[model samples]
Target: MDPKTASNLSFILNKPHDVEFKSRDLPTLSDPHDVLVAINYTGICGSDVHYWTHGAIGHYVVKEPMVLGHESAGTIVEVGSAVTTLRPGDRVALEPGYPCRRCGPCLSGKYNLCPEMRFAATPPYHGTLTGFWVSPADFCYKLPESVTLQEGALVEPLAVAVHIVRQAVVTPGQSVVVMGAGPVGLLCAAVARAFGASTVVSVDIVESKLAFAKSFCSTHTYSSQRIPAPENASNIRALAPNLAGGADVVIDASGAEPSIQTSLHVVRTGGTYVQGGMGRDEITFPIMAMCLKEVTAKGSFRYGSGDYKLAVELVASGRVDVRKLISGVVDFEDAEQAFEKVKEGEVIKILIAGPNEKKE
Candidate 1:
């Protein structure tokens, strides 16, 4: 049980609802610019839970046992000789995905769209759940002294919201309607608010989530009531009376078909609509409504360059408070319990203390 000689203990998923703690080889720097991080905190993501219960998400299948976690922050335990931006003992958020630098999307700074991206907790790629994880120095965003490692773990989802809101091009004085008051939806509302949107309304079927969204970031909230998309849209518009007719931008953070359909009706003419959630690969769209409104529909994948950086800034500056979203934290020994809590709708967001985490 010596500190330095301990193996790399990882929480791995062998199949749906079948997970185990296995010791893997401690990760080492793969390049001169890579750094080895001792993960301190990790957030339970929806994708992680999906892989746990379904063993696959879309095309990404867990053909083999894969480490299960990606949203993480850790202390750099060692750095390669070429790493100058980060060093040993530095606290950083581990950006789980890295692309081939030679890709066109990468050269254009749209690495999130790169064809050959290796995203952790995704198929064929190990995640940051181990005692030690390695990542390129540039991908590991350094956290401000004021930010806790647990908060740093939130950068991943916050960056996701950042990308979605940016895709909508929300401007100051404009109104935005975000469908689905989950973590991403709630954060989308917060990010839009931070972007200076005059009114941000969060809509959801659950009254509790709507209640949380109202207090968390949104200027207004609406209950979907399982009505027709247009009726729901009209009710949502009424919540943001500052908006003329409808919202300037609409975002679907809930991949539910009804939410997606409502988003199209929620946006005003010539406004933008961004789909940030992952539902079915195919869904029916209201093409007529889109054409009539001339709405610009865009799909937001994952975060790209500057998204994570801005997410950190938004939190560090108190513009977007991620701390309010966190519901609880559990030690690494109890990581499975954290997943179960999220699966059962018991918490908003939960963080897992990394193996060997130092207790305060």
Candidate 2:
């Protein structure tokens, strides 16, 4: 297959806010286990915005023109010879990353940590933010009839939340605090509740986002901007009286240093603390306090095996309402506006459609 033969409408990041829609040749499946999909909807992610603005995320730099977007859902248009689980016309969510299955991490069922992961829209890999894309059949989960393509696109982010909740081992009657009311944070709160957490508190700087968090599944919402930061432990206790009383688990989805610091201060002794968001490579952690409380702190990257499947189940079983999180949908041509909305932090999730988009 020649690179010139692929047909795609890519949002090329030439400059900030400058998106180019190019028509290239269609992509072909190289491996017998691969499948070709006609993408219908792609969700604008924060990482996509980061790449658009800074042109780099951590060590992954966009040195050349690259397609943006990873959260996507589509219908199978073709399948390779060895693929038996999926067929043409199957509606599915494309798990954007494909890891080296022969690696140690893959054998240990932690493929998300595989060092040779080819994640879409991340760098050196084209993304699914186009009309058609190719991926391994195993990475694509078939969506149930009840789930729409939009909901299928949401499965990508929901999978991250699912993985975090599983890592935290959230159980019934446990009190959970989610610092950050972004899309992932809201999804985490919803999944935690589905996993039987008795109480879920979402803290964010935006009151509107906090209000939106309540609509999904959070038991309580707090605006940290409204509550000034404390100068000492006494002030911290006063600010988060309910949480200072002790939380069984704290998930930092904001990636902000302050939120990470407060998570340690508010979590109960022996509680679990999980970092679900990415921020600076290094920060001043409360190591002494974490040690004193015997808190278990862990970092959650992208979703691992079975996370995407569970994410689809959560939506299909009506356990999590993903539609409420969708702020707006834009045509494929207006995809740039979707990114702008995300930059403005005015929407929870934005869905971009293809040329043949059908109303749902």
Candidate 3:
């Protein structure tokens, strides 16, 4: 395929465990609010990997070949006539989901829950893993001088962490316990600390991940692989003896049954618990324990209205150092290898460069 004639060069998942590069027509501005971006970097999220391995996540099945990426940042190549916020050559981080503005959830400022949301890399909606992509001008946040396109790509996951922190109502001087030490988990811990959590304890099964957490954002890290699920609460409390009784806020970014069960136990009475990760749809939950403690448990989805903006501010302000979680990066041609590394659970966060860049 001639580079000049090709409309788009994209890394697509033809099916489960099968991904390849294909040429397609260039995407045009469908709406006046649309801005065409020359993609610079895209972070491979866990959901993208799940789709590659399992062919689906819950009801969002991969019925057709779809582009595979959502965490992305790029430079604006074109802007629609009415688009005023962004211009050509402006660097931006794209918010992958476009929700219907007329929905009740949207009207109430909880647009992440909008039923008519068209999310990238979510089944029908093609993602941003391509040479060029189009997104609403409002959803594309311009990056500051200090934030690189690589760090801009991290804004998506950081937005998720911000949403989790916001939902949990993390207050100053509160004790926070974050389960799991993957990218999101680490970001959650980072956001919690940025939100003014006095003590942030990170619990994970892997020692390396725990070490990363301790160095990244966590005040302390604990290896919980050997602890029984039921004893996780007490074990976590023992690690953070500074907490009066238990964690004031427990955010389970692990989504493991044991982690979820442990969250209910570790959170102090009248404390908040936020479910930030996606594991099995069904689990053996300790319902009675939750009720007995009157824990305010809330389920966090992607992100809300101010999350992306807040995430950007957090990055630009240097309070939440997103670059700390970046373990490695690969060029566009090595996208498959990057995903493979993620599958093998070898890195914290790996970013894939755009097609214009040479493999390094």
Candidate 4:
């Protein structure tokens, strides 16, 4: 077969908020297990903004003009010979990571930790922020009729929240405190409620974001900036008495130092605390408080094996109203402005339509 040549428009990151529309060759399926998708919508993520501004996130650096989106949904236009689960015309959410199935982590069902994982929008690996993207068939989950392409695009981040909830092992009648009202934090609160948490508190410095959280899932909202920094656990207990009074779990989606510190202080002894966001690689944590409380701390990476499936199910069943989180939709030409909105912390989730004529 001859090599298929096609043009795809992508958001290229040259610097912070320095995104430009560029034409690139459409990617091809290198293996029989691959599938090609015509992207419909992609969401602006925090990591994408970090890469645009800093050119790197931790060890992953953008050495070339890399496409800048991972959370996406699209229609399958082509399928490889070995692919049987998905077919042409199927609308699906693209799971951005493709791991080497032979790796220890992958074989153990923890593919998110696979050392040889090739994830989109993560330096070196081109992302799905384009007119067309090609991915492994197994990673493209079919969307049900109830799920819209916009909601499908949001499943990626929702899966992250699901994974955090799973890691925390939240149970019914428990209380959860999510430290961030960003997309992930809001989703975490939503997922926590869906998972049967009796009370979920979402905290953030932004009052508008907190209000948004309340509208979606949070039972309680706190503007952390308004509260004085706790000098110790007792101080935190006083400030957040209701939440600190024996909360079962605390999820830190903010990735901020103060949030992390407060999570440890607010969680009851022997309760779980999961770090769902990536902030500085290292931060000054209150180790003494964590040890004294015997807090169980875990760092959550991206979604693992069952997370994407659960996220899709949540959207399909209407358990998670992902569409409510979408703040605005922009055309592919205005994709840069979408990223700017996220950078300015002005939007919750901005969905960028693929390269197509604008709908009337």
Candidate 5:
């Protein structure tokens, strides 16, 4: 390829803690239903930083240089011949993952479980932290007039929370307890409230995060204690006694073993438990207690089916405001600094500006 033929500038992760800016060849529509987007903003996810510093996530290893972002929004500069919902100059959020539509899970509307899913920023798949990207037109959600591209980039995490809340089956007049105060956790609490949960409690080990949660979405916050898991569960129940036995739904977004243990114990008998955080591959589970209480335990992966679309509607309607979760934004050239800040635990959700636009 000639040097002049390349115009897609991207931040490539060459190895652990090593990233370089390079102009990749402009991406093309791989299928008749695909669309090309000019990336405008990209958010830093924990998984993104992990890949940048570890060169791999689980079995997904970086054997070659790969682009470095997935949470993103961009302008659709070109659409495939079969695409109809989008056209040139449309602003939309990139879902960043596409599964094989030929699988049983895909047919069942659970494509997130498809074994052949090609997720961006994972091994061998280029991410969206670039000037241009290509994705299926169906995965690209157009931003309404009420939403901004900065907010559009947040649809990914919001979709994760939506899926978690959906798995938990959160309902009106119920109490929901969310473990962890990160972006996803906070969003989970918010979505639960939007789903009609009467009381939302956010639990975290950090007092500051809990404070932020109280102001952001949760009706209450619990700072973890050094006591036993059962006692912690009891104390959490004391914070919100609206539910009889305990919280109607318990979600673990922290992935910490202690949180997991307490989350299982915190759910009322016959209540639901959803694991949404990324922890170790294995942990000491309280299977017996869960069995005795008849707790329904479910694992939440990435968003699925109507998750992204619902997330967009939630944000657009102001039911779940993600703007408060944004800690800061950095320019595209300083994308490395954004990664460093997140690695150092200095920011919540920081976005990197694309070359096509300045700070929004």
Candidate 6:
């Protein structure tokens, strides 16, 4: 261990809307396959905000003083005896979820669904907001010289987009409409284009968000506030006649009830619809239209096998650029303030430097 590594400082959430900086024990490599990392950058995710403001997401509740953050990148500070793929000083993007390799889902190569999976920032599991995080060597991906630490932190979310696109089997010469102009939505659009979608339309209530989406990879932008939910599909079709025939797929990143309903009306017959966003646990669906159109609706979770690797390839190959989506990068002391901006919809993606505070 480095001589500077004594104790660790972390941002902890005592409860809903209550955050504090606390001294934490320096993590040691307990398993031979584990690698201890000095966290360099951690992105503020929407789920983190949901936990901060609501104290829980679904069954996961923050009853204890849990550390908050998951999208993170760092350098290996120490490696266990059995680890060989990475060593100290190696830059890496830490994959936050690691499942028991003996589980049914693991055997089936869908480890993201493993029942015994433990994910960072989830209740009862401390996250990567601290100075040092210990993760499995296999789960920590080495970053190439071309990818920055900021881009590395973003790979987590980008992996989510990759999984969603893969689920839908996005293909060439197809028209895709993505609802919501949030960070994930924008990335989804970018990935859709990288996946060979002919036309990509982004829908949002905010013009600034739509503009941001267009600036990235959205071929067309629509303001949902101006168009009523009932007329969204029609207006989008009229605006882009090539898309008038109906979108080949619709990915809802907004998770709004209206967007969910609009998806049902807009997708072409036998089209695919993937829910990339999370909103109400239960919402009304246009089952009749769905059944009649034979639209295949699928829900996407975090990420699974081969997703993270592909995300890194997308960045390394220069096929998908994530830096444009970064709105700000703040110091560890200002993390709470950054989360406040997320709550107010003031920023797209903000990365908080680790407690050690190193710039790359």
Taken over the whole model, the C-alpha lDDT of each candidate is 0.90, 0.86, 0.90, 0.86, 0.91, 0.90
User: Where does candidate 5 stray beyond 4 Å?
Assistant: 1-7
Q: How many backbone clashes does candidate 3 have?
A: 0
> Can you write out model 1's per-residue Cα lDDT over 64-177, one digit (the tens) per residue?
999999999989888899989987888999899999989899999899998999999999998988898889899999999999998999999999999999888889999988
Q: TM-score: which is higher, 4 or 6?
A: 6
- Every model's TM-score: 0.98, 0.93, 0.96, 0.94, 0.97, 0.97
> Positional deviation of 346 in candidate 1, in angstroms?
0.6
Clashing pairs in 1: none
Model 4 CA lDDT for position 138: 87
Ranking 4 against 5 by TM-score, winner: 5
Error of 5 at 223 (Å): 0.5
Instruction: Please provide, for model 2 over 25-109, each residue's C-alpha lDDT reduced to its tens digit, 9 standing for 90 to 100.
Output: 7787899999988888999989999988888888988877888889999988889999999998899999999999999999999
| Model 2 bad stretches (over 4 Å) | 1-7, 225-244, 358-360
TM-score of 1: 0.98
Q: Clash totals for all models, in order? A: 0, 8, 0, 0, 0, 0
Q: Mark the regions of model 6 whose C-alpha exceeds 4 Å error after superposition.
A: 1-7, 226-228
Ten residues in sequence with the least summed lDDT for candidate 1: 1-10
Q: Of 2 and 3, which scores higher on lDDT?
A: 3
lDDT of 5 by residue, 1-360 (tens): 222343578999999988999988887777899998888889998999999889988899999999989999988888899998998988999999999999999999899999999999998998999888889999999999899999999999999999999999898999999999988999999999999988999999888889999998899999999999988988998885685488889999999999999988889998899999998889997887799999999999999989999999999999998998889889889999999998987888999988667455
Off by over 4 Å in 1: 1-3
lDDT of 3 by residue, 244-323 (tens): 47799999999999888888888888889999999987899888878988999999999999999999999999999988
Tens-digit lDDT string for candidate 6 (1-360): 471654478999999989999988877788999998988899998999999999899999998999999999998988899998998889999899989999888999999999888999998999999989999999999999999998999999999999999988999989999999899999999999999998999998999999988889999998885455558888877667667767889999988999998888888889999998999999997888789999999989899999999999999888899998888999898889989999999999999998787654
Winning model by TM-score: 1
Looking at model 4, report the run of 10 residues with the lowest lDDT sum: 228-237
| Greater-lDDT candidate between 4 and 6 | 6
